[model samples]
Target: MVWAWLRIAVAVVGFSGVVAGFIVNVDRARREGQDLGLVLANYFSLFTIVSTIILIVTFVIAGLWSLRNPGRSPEPRGIALAIAGITGPILLLGIVYNALLRGLPSEIALTDPSGIHSLDVWATESLHVIIPLYLLVDLFFASRRRALSWWSLAVIVAYPLLWLTYTLIRGGLTPDPSGAHDWWYPYPFLDPHGGGGWPSVLIYVAVMLVVLVAIGAGIVAVGRLRSRRAAARTSPVGAAG
Candidate 1:
């Protein structure tokens, strides 16, 4: 019951944060006199937004399941797999933003020099730092998680690959709303025309894919460890020992 409530709380906070960020972005776009449709498109195209949506959906379902099936052990394999799938990209989102992108110029520039800055900070921290940490905690300590097969790493990497492909293609096709550039990219690292060019972009993508797989492997390993401990607690041999 407690765990279920925690999941629900996490979901609520995540939803609120994402909405706040979106609203702030919209306001900033309006203030800057940019195209609202382009702003909306770029906003949802963000990996952070998409990953948070996945996290929110996964937790909402997991929390509700726990509430309805109190005391259940080893949640359905599908749920466990969903959790595994999200763990990698979400953690990567937090890491990449904090390490590389924090304080960088964003598509939605600050609306008034004075106002909405604090709100933006709060929304950014909530989405990038706080929720990701909570999800990490849940991954390590939450109840009802089942061990996933090693092959689940492929499932984990699949979404990111698709997102990368979509982002690159879209970046090439989408016009810059500010008219400052011919094409717009969500992150500088992914921008092929930046100082690094296609080679640098590919290098970054390759490194990121490798790191993502490592994280996914770690999640799967932790799940296996937790599953073993759980089984031990219930096994007669473990009880006897």
Candidate 2:
């Protein structure tokens, strides 16, 4: 019960952090004379915003459901697992990219080009760090167990594929605002004109695909292990023998 409330509290704060960061970004963009469409077009900002919203809604619903039916399982167990599976990789992607490839905000302001507020960094961390950690903890250690299938990993990967496809199509059509290239790729590595060409982009994509697969495998393995342990504890002594 205490853990349930803690999860709810964390979800609310995490959601608020993402929203705050988004507001900062939007406000800064407006001040710089950038349109709302361009601000919203950013993949990181958009993904974090949507994912946090999902966390908020799912956690709140689960918490309330638990309260109403104290001994029963949480409602929408499958959806909760699905949300965790999808957002877990995304959170990792953001953290790894920023920390390793992009450098920290203290080292270099990653949001400088985007004109987002300073506090947006913390907000970004909330999505990529806090919320992801919270979800993993809740999924593994918290009550009201749920089982996830391996096939759902395919479902999780489908989203990023669609996002990449959209990004590529849009980049080809839209001109870069920075005057650096004809196409507008969200990341420099994805830009054919500036990112060394299709070969470079393909290599990066391949590496990312491998990382995504690993993330999926890890989540599934941990989840299945937890499920099996729960099953083992609950089985009758005669059946176990």
In each prediction, how many residue pairs overlap at the backbone (N, C-alpha, C within less than 3 A)?
A: 0, 0
Worst 10 residues of 1 by lDDT: 106-115
Deviation from native of the Cα of residue 176 in model 1, angstroms: 1.7
Candidate 1 lDDT over 165-205, as tens digits, reads: 99999999998878889899988999988888999999999
Give residue 187's error in model 1 in angstroms.
Answer: 0.5
lDDT (10s digit) by residue, model 2, range 57-173? 767766766666677353365655655556656555565556654553431154356545456767867767777677667666777656677876786677667767877778788
**What is residue 171's positional error in candidate 2, in angstroms?**
2.5
- How big is the RMSD of model 1? 1.5
Candidate 1 regions off by >4 Å? Answer: 105-111
The estimated TM-scores of all candidates read 0.95, 0.78
Model 2 misplaced regions, further than 4 Å? 43-45, 72-77, 102-116, 176-182, 238-241
Q: What is the C-alpha lDDT of each candidate?
A: 0.86, 0.66
Q: Of the candidates shown, which would achieve the greatest lDDT relative to the real structure?
A: 1
